[model samples]
Target: MTDYYGILGVDRDTSFDEIKKVYRKLAREFHPDVNPDPKASDKFKEITTAYEILSDPEKRQRYDLGGDPFSQFSGGQNFGFGDIMDAFFGGGGGNRGPRARMRAGQDALIRVELDLAEACFGAERELNLETAVACEKCSGSGCAPGTKPNVCAICKGRGETQQVTRSIIGQVMTSRPCAACQGYGSVISDACNECAGDGRVRSRKSIPIKIPAGVETGNRIQMSGAGEVGPGGGPAGDIYVEIVELPHDFLVRDGNDLHISIVIPMTSAALGTKVSVETLDGSREVAIKSGFISGETIILKDLGMNKLRGHGRGNLIVHVEVTTPNKLNKEQEELLKSLAKSRGESQDDVEIHHRGGAHSSGFFGRFRDAFNR
Candidate 1:
């Protein structure tokens, strides 16, 4: 006797629910249509037979008692049409008729590069792509200029055929897609030469797309009906435009905020000055406060990228980097030396500034002091 439980990889005392679950998983895995392995058909049959006997209460009882229940049926007993149909169709009862030749097209994706300014503000651009488009010669029909498709005689326009097979379980009837018309219920006479009867041709097309404001890298914009046309000239799918932001020369974007660094002379920082900065909107003047230090950040509100799908805008952050004079003339050196002596200090004796009454020393400490001020 064959052990149905072992075949299904389950315990002998397993419940019906568990056995059904295992059978379904194994059946789908080993089904001939899903798994192309040469032995898959035989394995599927084995799993089906095991499930059939174990799932029936009477058959299971007889099998558990070491009796073959199938032996009780004589050769004179005949299987009903519904029983045979159920065995082949899995209880679907009837056929589903012909399938449609034309189907909805598939969506496509392409990446486009955008400048930082273009991403900050909305823009319209043209894109070129190669995809399947409807054939102009046949007007989206698979037939030639003068002829049309005709009904298939083999399937009588039903697109399927019935067959009977004798197996160990008895005679079973099944229906399969007809080969004559390829399940389309019709055959094209004199197929279109331009599209090879598929009703579509591969061609390059240019389309205009609108990019909204504040679009960042990795953002996707959907363009409807811009994808490949279906095989039989069906509906066109959507084309997704993926945004790739190009590196900016002066700005670094983080979310909706923009950051930039600028260098100012030590004298300009101490005396206060105004400098022109190239922003996304345009060139604007930014004021440097007196006694400005390196690493100090100045925020310009509403000067950054626009908020995506929102109303407000982000701020532009400016980091000040004070530039020290690399070369000094003798007169300049003398003047600096005199100024330092007047402040009660020498070039060798560096003054350490305290912040919030906290005494700290080093480059990092000076950086912290700069920001603290």
Candidate 2:
């Protein structure tokens, strides 16, 4: 296998932060998005994979023990270090060459939409997923029970072969895996029919997932070891459950706070009234003060969504909008006119005048004044 340090173009003594910095720089330079060259893209992927493994302590430990992290390791199934090296770098030949089988398929993502109540209160979901599972016929092995695979004679079990290339200065050296044996240094003569000489098959599975309370949109619930079965009878990867919160009919969310707009009649704004507010739990009576103005907010403490990773709930802000009566009956109009007459004396014309100011007239002057203010 390529040295993680070498792949990252850093020294073995480099710190974790230094390693990350170097990886980011190299990734930016060689990323497929920035560099269209196929070779650069492949190299970028290789380096990124190497950095991902090395930066993680658990994966790095496994790699240090000569283990192929991408392959399955449980149940005595193992991958040769040579095969890992050949898989990343081409098997010492011009051809892509045979590669070792991998285990623990890969993690998958699925989106689930939940209402605000469900996101706050939590719920159980039954997921129908189609993934690769181990074959039952040969017990995860490609060979039948009685017979086993034979050693490959092409690469002599080394899984790779050396090549000599002519260069201007001298002979160049390269290595690749033997095509016949596929880097396993062995071939299954009587392969199992169930898995078609591989070790896994596609099957449908139903799993129950309990979404935790206080989960928000874009939050992921990881189901450990629930992913696809690895190649060659390896362990399974994890499955990530992505949450997508549905929009509520009456409320909009901000962090954990719930904002709602409530419409009240003009009479209700003048005369205090108790309103029945709907909530996830049930309904509650909220009192509106007399002489309430439009665009005013009433805060209901601890009535919002629960904190995703903390204790206590957020406040619910209710914005009030007073609806004015557009069409008034004769009696209503007469009563309003009487009320206005009692408030003050009526006048025919009222003249308003503005004192002269530097920006009171011109457009640009007003614009500049607006910005300065």
Candidate 3:
């Protein structure tokens, strides 16, 4: 009889967490991949067997009472960490039952472009998509009518097979997944022709998605359970609809604020005029006051993009660009000369601005005097 506690290098009253920590350290050192020495393999197996027996409370009690616990391991009942490691380390691993065919589907992503108006005002868009859906013929069973999968004869439903081979130490037993069943333990002899035993088919679908206001480019809208249908009719994954906002003709967006530039003649800037400005709502009038500057802006409240999460909309900014009148007639040129002469700027290099009987000077002073009106 082997002393399980002595093999694990732990006391009889050692905590399970402490025991697990010690066992993991020894496993790392004595694992065949880490240690080239032939004796390390046997030592690793001994410690693993001891750890398995001691980890289970009932099995440890039986071993403490001088009862055989090896019977339990031989029956291949308890599947633990050590048992799983054997499959990867070329040892005769414990029997692993058939793997299920059904699994959760994978998430999918698709990008859709939206009109600027559509993004400002929420709109419904029908998406044409191609995704995997459960096959209709066999209801995701992957079998034809009146027939089902049969147990694999090679591994006898165990999903793996053990083989003994000669090594330097002696006969070393190794286990591998059965080739015929591919670890599924069952062969679909009468596979469904539609999905070809995958239980899902590639099909086109039309899904309607609502485009929320204020959703800009690169924003993703997640639709739960709208992605690919998992193999064997498992639950569908989420579908992410990414937004790509289309460019507006005249308006450029900065956050929630919409900006547009309009050019007006210098006469319109001198004399007050009204202009038609297009907003998210519709065309609105923006008054350009007399002597409106070239780089001035007129903001319309609550006329921009709607807020995605909060109340109220953003502002629409109208950028004004005053253009000088070109191709003036003789009468217009004579009238402008008469107006300039009357203002006393026709002969002087720059009209001096007087402050308390003193002439203001310098570049900044000249600039201030030029636009003082």
In order, how many clashes per candidate? Answer: 0, 12, 0
Q: Which stretches of candidate 1 lie over 4 Å from their true place?
A: 1-96, 136-139, 145-148, 156-177, 327-329, 346-351, 354-373
Candidate number of the best TM-score:
2
Q: Give the clash total for candidate 3.
A: 0
Can you write out model 1's per-residue Cα lDDT over 199-258, one digit (the tens) per residue? Answer: 789999887778999999899987555687776655567778999999887787878888
Model 3's alpha-carbon lDDT is 0.73
Report the Cα lDDT for residue 24, model 3: 70
Preferred candidate (TM-score higher): 1 or 2: 2
**Considering summed lDDT, which 10 consecutive residues are worst modelled in model 3?**
75-84
- Candidate 3 structure quality by residue, lDDT tens digits, 280-309: 789999999999977667889989898887
Off by over 4 Å in 3: 1-98, 145-148, 158-177, 351-373
User: What tens digits encode model 2's per-residue C-alpha lDDT throughout 35-66?
Assistant: 43546646765776677666666667787788
